[model samples]
Target: MENHLYDGLIRYIIKKTRLDKGLQQRDLADLHISDGTISNVERGKVVVRDDTFNYLLNKLGLDGGKLNELVKKEKEFIEHLKFRLDCIESMLNNGYLELANEELKLIHLDEFHPLAPFLMYLKGRYIYKKKE
Candidate 1:
């Protein structure tokens, strides 16, 4: 599960960076790898060796260390988001509807995000409380 999460996150980062830099997958190709492999990596459909992964990042001009730093920060932010959601849940359980709603307003996560279902569940709970 953890490995899948890492792969997905890496895929997002690579694709976003490549698009942002206006580079096509073929642009990353060299003698060591093909554009199809690059596409597979961006889609999280295949795992490559560490050297190959680093090579792809190098092609995007993103240093491996810098990518690691971005990953660390992303993980930290996700942890913080989970903590906030827990707090919102606790607020709802304790009948702090306004506070939970306020916290919900502060959060803006993509529906495809891993924790989005939890957020949706909380929203349902909040609505139930209102109906009561």
Candidate 2:
């Protein structure tokens, strides 16, 4: 069968639920999946089966309107992160290291932050590129 288009909406729903429940990726994986599978789902590269999705939603204590709102917020956050990354990249390329650093600091303060390490690595690379 042709693969379904990867859905950021679904991915975000899972992410928010996981974070709300304080479950790490490994912890969720141990419930009946592999860590790699969870990673793929979070990245929106794979579609999970309906039964598995329902199990996750139930486990996370999400249903009805609350679940819908979680998915909506996830999409919003994902879009915001994309925009923030773009802005950070532009600032770095324009020699605005201080601004980029400030944004990175903000991200570090978020509980479910994912890109802080990657952003730091990019900052190091930016410095190196400038020296070359």
Candidate 3:
């Protein structure tokens, strides 16, 4: 599928928020919104209104500059993550499983701050895949 810039941006923000909080997708879904809505927003297919955006930020316990900063950091962070993931995959393919595993572990340990729950979901995916 063609990637939509807004979708990518939103997804990045969602992920950042989730990671900071250290909660799983289902756990986050139980607190504020549903997993489907989170996925949809991250995909950028759905348009979020200002009220909803404010709600999300507030629910995630963001206020003032931190919230603004997160929005501003979205683009750069997403690009970096994409690049890192590509590198990790390449390493795994080139017999660098140990290195890749190390990198993955770092990601797992890194706190997403307020987005911990969402980050937990991504971590779960990474761990699940590693086990497979």
Candidate 4:
């Protein structure tokens, strides 16, 4: 589910930051944290509570406020991209080839993007319509 995806993303970020700082899971220990909790969190075998997650972030010397802001912006950006893809699909379905092509031009999604296949489908529809 989307919640799992968010958890995965957050855990991955934490793991990456720890590694980038040349710290191992054991190095992130807190007085209240038991052995292996950090490792389990990094591996995502267990879900970390917000307080524990914030503690881990603090141990890494990361600014939790900034990280939260980045996550918020990323969510908003994804929503906007989804909206654009929907508009592109509607344009293609309505036989508005010129408008569809123009809208497609504005989207620069990565080749491996989750929506890439849908974008390709829309482009194919535009191409097929042109040959009609």
Top TM-score hit: 1
Backbone N/Cα/C clashes per model? 0, 0, 22, 0
Colliding pairs, model 4 = none
- lDDT agreement of model 1 with the native: 0.79
Report each candidate's C-alpha RMSD, comma-separated, in the order given: 4.4, 5.0, 8.3, 6.9
Candidates' C-alpha lDDT: 0.79, 0.66, 0.59, 0.71
Model 4, residue 129: distance off in Å is: 2.7
Candidate 1: the clashing residue pairs are: none
Q: What is candidate 1's lDDT per residue for 102-122, written digit by digit as tens?
A: 889888875545577899999
TM-score of predicted structure 2: 0.57
Worst 10 residues of 3 by lDDT: 108-117
Task: Assess the local accuracy of residue 62 in candidate 4 as a C-alpha lDDT between 0 and 100.
Answer: 61
Error of 1 at 4 (Å): 8.5
Question: Candidate 3: lDDT of 2?
Answer: 27
lDDT of 4 at 112: 38
Two-way lDDT contest, 2 vs 3, winner: 2
Lowest summed lDDT over 10 consecutive residues: which window, candidate 2?
1-10
Q: Number of the top candidate by lDDT?
A: 1
Candidate 4 has its poorest 10 consecutive residues by lDDT at: 1-10
